[model samples]
Target: MSKTEAAARLAVRKTYKLYIGGAFPRSESGRSYPVTSSKGEFLANASKASRKDARDAVSAARKAFGGWSGATAYNRGQILYRIAEMLEGRRAQFVAELAEAGTKKAGDVVDAAIDRLVWYAGWSDKITSVAGAANPVAGPYFNISSPEPTGVVAVIAPDEPLLGLVSVIAPVIVTGNTCVVVASERAPLPSITLAEVLATSDLPGGVVNVLTGSVKEIAPWLAAHMDVNAVDLTGVADEDLAITCEQAAAENLKRVLRPAAADWYADPGLKRMTAFLETKTVWHPTGV
Candidate 1:
C-alpha cells in the first residue's frame, strides 16, 4: 500500500458525546453540531444537547448527590486527586484540543488546569475546618456550624474553555456537590475529552455530567430545575441571557453564581466553593 493511503487508514476520527450518569450518550434528541478548529478545519460532530438532555443530567446529578455528599471527605479528596493524576497522564491530548480550539497558550492552560484540580483536591477535607465555626453561647450549650453540599449544581463553562472549565468544576465537586456542566458552546471538544478522563477516574458516576451544546437552549432548563440546588453562570457572557437564567433560578431560590469575567489562572479564593455550600448549625446541651 502507498504511504499516503496507509497514513489515511491509520487516522481515527472521534465522535464527541455527552457524559451523563458516567456514560457517553448521544443527545436524546439525536442532534449534533459541527466542531471546527481555529483554521476552520473540520474536527468532529459534538452532541448538541437539548432540554431533555439537561433534565436527564440533572436527574443523574440528583441521584448521585446523597452518596457523594455522605462519603468521607478524605475519600472525596482521593478521588479528586486521582482525577488530577489522570489529567496529567493525558496532558498531551488536552493540549492538542486546546490548540485546535485556537488557544495560543494550550500547554500552559493544561498545566494550570491540572494544578487547579490538585489545589481543589487538597481543599476537600480542609474546607469544613476553614469555613466552619464554633460559637460561644450565652447559655450552657454547644453551637457549631459547618458547610455542607448544596445537592445538584448546574455549571455553565466559560469561553476560555479548558482552564475555565477546570476552575469552576473543581470547586463545586471537591466540596461534595454533584454537577451538570454545560461546556463552552464554541469550544466543547476539550471539555468532552475531559469527560472521558473523569469516566476512567475513581470519581463516582453521575458526580460530574457534561453537556456540549447551546447554553441558550439548555441553561434555562437547568436553572429552573426544581431538583438543581444551585446554578453557576460564570460562562454566560450575554447579559440578557444571564439575567433570564438567573430569574429562572429564582424559581426555587437556587444558589446563583452570577456571570463575571474571571482570570482563570489567578487565585479562585473560596467564593466558588462556598457558593454551592449550605451552612448547618447544631446545638447540643452542655449538661448532658
Candidate 2:
C-alpha cells in the first residue's frame, strides 16, 4: 500500500475525544458506539456524549463567552481567517470523510465546505458594520444601534456532515458567539475531525465544542439548559423533535432559529447574521 493510504488507515484507529473547555476528554458517560461508513462498512467507534457532557459543554461555552465576544472585531476576523487557513490544509481529510459519509461528489462537499469557511471568514470583520447601525431620532441625543453576540449558543449541526455543519457554526463564531455543537447522528467522524482542526486554529479554548451522539438524546438537554443564550435547530427535520426543542426553549425564551424549508446552498441573505444578533440601542445626550 502507498504511504499515504497506510497513514490514513493508521489514523482512523485513533479514538476520538470530546473538545470541552479546551481540553480533550473521553465522554463523561464513558460510552461509545460503532461508527459506520455510508456504505455500512465499519469505521471507528465514537464517544457517545451524555447529558452530563452536554451540561459541561454549556459551562465551558458560558465561561468562554465574555472574552470571545468582547474581542475587537479585527481580532475576531484574524482568528476566523486562521481557521480558514487550517481548513485548507485539511481538505484531503474532509474529502475522505465525505466519501465515507456517502456524499455524492465528495469534492463538491469539500469545495462547498471550504467556500463556506472563506465566506464566513470575510464576514468576521464586516458583520458588525453590516448588521449594526447608527439610529437617527428627532431629539438632540445621538442614538446608536449596535449588535452583540448572544452569550452562549447551542447548535444542532446539519445532518449532511459538511455543509450543514459549517452553515450552523461559521455564523455563530464569526460574530463572536461561542458554541456547543452536536455533530450529525449518522455522520460524527467528520465533525470530530473538524474539531481537531479548530483546536489547531487560533480559536480560544471552549470557544467551540463538539459532541458526537444522538441529537435526540442530547439536543433536548441543550435546549433546556438555562445558561445557553440561544439554540439553533437548523438540522432538526422531525416536526415532533422541532416542537419539543421549541417548547424547551420557552423555559428561558432562548433565541431560536427554526429549521429552514428552503435551500441553504442558495445565496444566504442578511438573515444569517441577523438571526443571531441582539440589537443594542445606546443613548447619550449632548447639551449646548
> Cα-based RMSD of the predictions, in order?
1.6, 3.4
Model 1 superposed RMSD (Cα): 1.6
Report the C-alpha lDDT of model 1 over 35-140, residue by residue, as the tens digit. Answer: 9899999999999999999999999999999999999999999998899999999999999989999998899999999999999999999999999999898999
In order of listing, the candidates' clash counts read 0, 0
TM-score against truth, every candidate: 0.97, 0.94
Q: Point out the worst 10-residue segment of candidate 2 by lDDT.
A: 3-12
Per-residue CA lDDT of model 2 for 93-154, tens digit only, reads 88888898888888787787778877887887787787778888888898888888987899
Top candidate when judged by TM-score against the true structure: 1
